[model samples]
Each structure stands twice: as structure tokens, then as C-alpha cells.
Target: MIPSFRLFPDSASTVSGEVNGFFICMLILCSLMAIGIAALIIYSCLRYHRAHERAIGDQRRYNVPLEVTWTVVPFVLFVGMFVWGARMYFDIERPPDNAISMYVVGKQWMWKIQHPEGQREINTLHIPIGQPVKLTMTSEDVIHSFFVPAFRTKQDVLPGRYTTTWFEASKAGKYHLFCAEYCGTKHSGMIGWIYAMPRKDYQTWLTQGAAEGSMASMGEKYFHQFGCANCHHFNNQGRCPDLRNLYMRPVQISTGETIIADDNYLRESIYDPNAKIVYGFHANIMPNFTGVIQPEQVAEIIAYIKALGPQPGAQEPSNPGTAPSTYGAQKGLAGPGATSISGSEVQER
Candidate 1:
């Protein structure tokens, strides 16, 4: 049975416990301070009442020790509080290395979430009860906040940048979520619910949600919709790598060294493609889809690559023989990563 108001959600991860403890401590300290201040105010009013007031000489004067003590004590308390809060903040922001990642886009009226497993939701988040879920979120237009009060986690999602928030729900239940910030006219309607379910139930939800147009399928749809095929197709005249199976594949460099095309590499290739030039591709031709594709879509694209079953030999570029010619040496077009790649020779393999 669930209680009416829970101070803390079920503890599933290490940081939640610390967060709960810190929250409780804060509540206790605040309560004590409020009570003490109230009591002192009442006592001063009664003792120093005008009817019973003494002469001017009998009143207290400035005390250097008292002044210093008041200032120093508060300073120390604030510093300690800051340090304690910072520790918890850092731990919560930086999730474990193996934490499962999810992408959330805070829009004007709703929260769009894309699970790593291809499940998508609108204003409803479904997370595994005991798994550490790291949410990489950004706002589409204005500043927004992703908040889950029960889990004691909230993160600002700003446009043109990325921010992350993470938490692990201990017990399986439905919890309320809100956009703690006053965003706009529909801010009140931006409320949502987080469904924390058992691991098996979460898996079942993923499978059920992915029955149609899964992440990979949506990615493929977007890839085609965005006209990526015009320049990325093997038989086409484009100067970019084929989009068949780019993720997790060894990208051969000019120096003959092969580096795995991992997530960072792929992300760089998307927003700032020329950062690391593949052997045969021209960076300038690849447009930065940062503004075009939402962060959620980027995650979907990555998910599609992960689901592509194995990179087949047919997915390899057909223009491998033209590797020596750095197509990126000259500016091809005004695209996101192309500006950097132009006139830059391929340095590493």
C-alpha cells in the first residue's frame, strides 16, 4: 500500500539514499530555525515591551564578539551546506558509467522522451524501478526544467545546449512529475507522470511500445525524410560515408589506424562533423543537423544504428579506392562540420 505523501521514494541506487538524508536534514534544520526565530521574537517583544522599558543607559550596546560570532557562524553554516549540497549535486549529475541513458526534449507544452531501447513517450516517463536512468535533456525553444519531485531530481533544459539528470526509483509505482519552472502560458499543463515498474514489466513495456515504428525504424524514416540518402547513398555522387552501419564500426584513417565510430564520434559528426574526418569523406558536405534534428531524434538515429544487426560488407563505402584524395581539403558547401573540414588535411587514421 502507498502512503499519501512520501518524504522519499524507494531507494534503488546509492545516491538516492544520500539525497534523502540531505533532504531530511534540510527539513529538520529549517524547522528548528523557524521555531527558534519565532520563540526569540516572542520573548523579545514581551521582555522589551514599551510599558516595561528601562532607561537608555540600561539598554545593550554594540558587542564586537557577538557581531563576529553571528557573522562567522552563519558563514560557516552556509559553507558547510554548500559543500554538502555540491557533493550530492555532483554525484547525481554524474551517473555511473554503465547507467542506461534516455533522451528527453522539453518542449513548450509537453515532454518528449526517447528511451535507449526505442520506447518513446509524451509527457509520460516509464523507467525500470531499480535501474539508474540518466536523462540527457535539452529544451527545444525556451528554458524548461525536467522535474520529478518524488525522486528529488530536477534539471534545467536549455536550448542550444545539453544538460543531464539521473535518478533510480526504488519501488514500482506511479509518481507525479512537473516542470517546476514557470515556462509559459501552458506551464500548468506541462505536468506529467513517471511510471516506475519492475524490471520485467519495464521490458514488457519496451517491447510493447516498440511493436510499431521503433527507434531504429523512426531513425530510418528520419534519415530518408531528411534527404540523407541524396548524398549518402553508395551509388550516389555524394562525398560522405554511407549511412548503412556507421556506429561501432572501425573507421580507417589516413595513417592506416582504425578507430571505432562510437557515440561521441557520431555525435561530433552530427553537430560538428569535421572534428574527426573519416578517410574518404568530405566534412564540409555534411550539414550540421543540430537545429534540424532534435536531441531525441539524434538518440533515435543512434538506436537505429545499434539495431542494424551487424555491419555487412555491403555497407562499406564503394569509394574506398579514392581515399588518398582528401575531399575535405577544399570547401564543398556551407554545412555544420564542413566549415572546419575545408582546407584541413586528414591527419590521423
Candidate 2:
């Protein structure tokens, strides 16, 4: 059966209606202002034109009330618009605490998606309605944009770094997904569909697939497979720094600089170990795995690292000298043949 065409896409997300309303308000205001200016121009031309082609025109200064009205009214409207837009921008940028996390890897002309439950999809995404879904996306090649017109959400996926965006489906239906950026020759073909289903149906869909395991579980396997377990151990007895409770915490480098152990930091540490050395660790101890592993493997390893720690908001040690209670006072342990750094100097702050 043939489907009927519509001028605008369906509003299938929680924020789509708000976004549409704001857009329409702006459009109507601009259109009215344009029409008013055009009408004034036409009226002036007809009412005050030269009577005989040699008629002299009268010089007049602008009225204070008219000038003030135009200036103040636009300034107020513009400030209002700025405030409204900024509020919406922040609301969209910050995902809720309970959002379901999903990973997306964009490369060439296709999108690779992995759910937290380990189900993988290519060019197609299935999300549950009424629940917020947050996507942590990165590109394996050139830049690509993850855009969904119906949800009114778009974010650029860049190489070597992670970009995130979230949206909650309001309606259970299929929505169009597009790579808004001009990627390569097959950019036009880089299109997909988002299926928003009921929570029960979505859970059934997840169970239908033959899953390897959760993303974190898969990452743990990769962590061991890549020989990372040899040097970096969870028990703090390893020659290298401890991996326990390290995610999202500040790490001091050798150069006396502090940086967060975010996804990008983990990726860089794997691909290029020498880029940013941890404050206590020396370089050349960890081998560079630039061409050895794919981006998906790196993501999995990061997931495993994330799993080792308390997810984001756990209470950190108040005392700088005190180590995290997870591994219990072993924060500064350096076994035999370990590169030297005093355990006391590795501050959790």
C-alpha cells in the first residue's frame, strides 16, 4: 500500500512539540515584521511620491517615540528569544540520571549500534517509548552527524572522541534517521529508521537476539585478551596503576596536570599511551595498540573499565591522603619491577 505524504515530519518525541512551537513563534514574528515593513514601503512610495517629477521633498527627523519603540521592542524580543533558546539548549544537552546508555559507532556509510544489553544493530535503532535513551557516539573514520528529524535532536559524531545526545520517544512508531553531515560518496545512502516500541515489546526484542553478554562483559574479555590485565590489575598488586574506581575521577599526569578519566582519555591511553602519562606512571611501559584493535573493541574495554568503578556519583574520599575504600588502602601499591611512584602522591582528587 502507498503511504500519503506530509509536509512536515511527525512529532514523535517528548521535546518535538516544544521545539516546533518555538520555531513557529519565531517564523510568525519574522513574517509579520517583514510584511509590515513591505507595506510601509509601498504606502510611502504611493502617498509621498513626486507630484510633477520636480517636486521638492521635505526633510524630517525621526520621532523619538517611533525610534524608541522599534529599538526597545526588538531588543526585548531578541533577549527573550535568547533566554528561551539557552534554556532549551541546556535541557537538551544534559541527560537525566536514569537514562539508558547506548553506544554508537559511525564509519564510512553505516552506523553500528550496541545496546547495554549487548544487542547490536546496523543502520537501525530500536528504542523503548516513554524512557529516555542516551547515545554515546563516536566515529571510526571521518565526521558524521546523528540526526533524527522527528525527535528534533542532532549531534556530531567525531573521530577519536565521544559526543552524546539523548531523546525520549513520545509515540510508538518509526522515525527517520539521517547522517546530516556530508561524509563521503555514499553519504546519501547513509540513512536508517528508529523504531520506538512499548517497554514490554522492547524487552522481548532484546531477549530474542543471541547476545554475547552485556557491553561491560564483552569489554572485560577484550581487556584480558589485549594483555591489559598483566600490567593493570583490579587488585592493585599489578606493576601499573590500579583500575578500581577510576572512571570519571581526576587523574594527575606526570606533567603535574589533572585530567578526567573520561572515554576519550581511555581511548587515547590505549591508542597512544605516551600522550598523557598518569602522574605516578612512567611512559613506554604500556604498548601502543593503534592498529591492533578496532574502535568497537576500544569501546568495550572502556565499558569494562567503567564497570570496575562506582558509576559516576559515588562519594569520593574527602582526605587527599586517603585512598578509595574499594581496594582498601592499596591505592599506592607498586609491586616488584614496578615503575616508581610513591603511593602517597597518587591523590584521588
Candidate 3:
């Protein structure tokens, strides 16, 4: 088996098996019902055949017990099927709490993925096996879909809103990831891969990235390049809300609704900022950056924030360092004992 192909239990296959089970039950019922019907037809034909021609008004009879038996039995069987199927539906829709998150962005011609560690890929995804992987996806330009044929999971990716799908690979293998929806002229080429590596390998990969320099740093670099830090910060420094610990916190909206800053909520707030503006921020101040920011950048930012931790003052810079703290400088600040930023180029343009 290919390393990325899931040969074991996965969201797609698990849900598929449940559906197939229902279908198999239906097939069996249909077969039995067919046999009984044939038997009744044959019996009626033979039993009613008289030696001589019968009168025009031959007596006809209906058996209430037979009618009730057939009707009630089928109804009970159907109810049972409904309950079973509904249970599976609910289970598949809600992912486990500890599921690993990967942000997916679908454009007309490509699928971009970002791991929480900030590893970015186009048309490919790397995930650890035997773990629940939840994909929070959105479209850049038009409608698209994220599909993994091996796992049997598909969810539409719409513009101006976010959609999610989750799956767990039972075994590790390379799987085909396709944009199931007709997105554009290049839709057919909108394909990628999913690498279900061992948990150790996944951790190793993450460590490798961090050793090289965390994706958070890369995300911070991109944040400025992508113009996200401009509007999203407070007091014209950034237009939207402060990014310091936005996730999973209770955010009070200008509309007077308090919301948990979860993945879906954050996704919506980014793609459709006017939907729920923060209590102090104005709606529409956030220009729709739908197609501008790449999926990889989004992942890096989220990863960077996640890595920043959840302490009370974690969001803010540690301390004031020095004047002329140029952009893109890795040194934290010019404070005492802080690393110096000497030869770093500050690009204001």
C-alpha cells in the first residue's frame, strides 16, 4: 500500500460502511419481499384457477392480518434503519475534541494546505496516522470542494464562508486529494496528496520546521507582506481586533453578541468580517481578503498564534526594546539582554 493511502478505519470509510450496512439491509429486505411476493402471485394464480370459467363477480377477499403484518413489519424495520443512520450522521459530523487541525484553502486551480506547525503545501497534506484530522476549509474565488476518495469524505468550500470536514486514517499511506467540485478551467488540475505518516515522523517533521525556525516566525513575516498586520491590529496599527489571544476566547461583538472564538467563528470572522464585528471595530473595515492571503499563510498565522501560548500577557511583545526596531528583524526588541538587530534591513516600502 502507498504510504499515504489509508488502508484502515477512517472517517470516510467508517461513514461509508454505515451507509453500506443500511443499503445491504435494504437489499436483503427487498430480496425477501420479492420472494414472498412471487410466492403470493403464484399461489393466487394456481388457487383461483377454476376448472370452468368463473362467474363475472367472483368473490374477492382481503386479509387484515396479512396487511397489518406486512405494513407494521416494514415500518418498524424502516424506523430502526433511520435511527441507526442518524446516529452515524451525527458521529461523522462532530469531530473529536483533540483532532489535529489543518487549514485548507481552495482556489480555482489549486488546493493549499497549512499544518499547525506552519508547513505549507500545494495540493498535498501531511498528517499523522491514527489521529483525527479536522480540515477547516474555504474557497478563494468560487465554490470548490475538498475530497479524499480513499477516506470517502467531501465538503464544499464556498467563498465568503468557511466549511469543515474531518477524518482519521487508520493506516498510513498516500491518498489522492481532489477538488470534487467544478471550480474553473483548471479544476481538473486542482489535485493534491495526503501523506499519513507515522506519529513519530509527524512530530519529527514539526520539530524539523521549528529547528529551522518556527512557522510562526514565517507567518509573522508573511503577515506584513500579506497586509494582515495592517488592518487586524488595534488603533490603525491594525484595523481589526488585536491578534494576541483571539482564539477560543469570548469575544464581545459590536452587535452585542458574545461568541467563543473557535475555529469556525474565526474563519467566518476573517472571510466575512461584517458578520460579527468586535464591540469596538466597525463592520466592513476589514476588506474582504478572500483571495489575497494564501492558505499556507493563514495556517502559519494561526500556528504562530497557537505557539504564542495563552498567558494573560502572552500576546504583547515581551518588553520595549529600542527605537528603530526595523521590520522583519528576528531580534525580539533592543531591551536589556535582548538580542541586537544590527544589520537587519528595514523595508518600509
Highest TM-score against the true fold, candidate: 2
Across residues 153-256, which tens digit of lDDT does each residue of candidate 3 receive?
Answer: 78899876667788887667788898889887888899988888899998887776533344567767777786777665532245466665444445567766
105, model 3: CA deviation in Å?
1.9
Please write out the lDDT profile of model 1 over residues 1-349, one tens digit for every residue. Answer: 6757865465544466788788789889889989999999999888867663553435577899999998998799889899999988877776654467678888897999887656778999998877788787777788989888778788898875567888888878887789987899999999999999999998888878844565667777777788775776543245766544344445664344455555555655777766777665665777778778867777676666545523222333332211323223222322333213223122111
- Candidate lDDT scores, in order, read 0.69, 0.81, 0.66
Question: Which ten-residue region of model 1 has the weakest summed lDDT?
Answer: 340-349
Q: Considering lDDT, which of the candidate structures 1 and 3 is the better prediction for this target? A: 1
Q: Candidates' TM-scores? A: 0.67, 0.86, 0.67
Model 1 CA RMSD to the hidden true structure, in angstroms: 9.8
Q: After aligning candidate 3 to the native by TM-score, how far in Å is the CA of 230 from where it should be?
A: 6.1
Worst 10 residues of 3 by lDDT: 333-342
Model 1 residue-pair collision total = 2
Score residue 124 of candidate 2 by CA lDDT: 96
Best by lDDT: 2
Q: What is candidate 2's lDDT per residue for 1-349, written digit by digit as tens?
A: 6688777779998889888889999999999999999999999999988799688887786799999998999999999999989988876777765688789999999999999888899999999999999898999899999999999999999998899899999999998999999999999999999999999999999999888998888888887798998999655666677876566556767886565677788888999999998766678999999989788888788888777766533444432212335233443442322223223233221
Which residue pairs of candidate 1 clash?
253-349, 284-338
Error of 3 at 251 (Å): 2.4
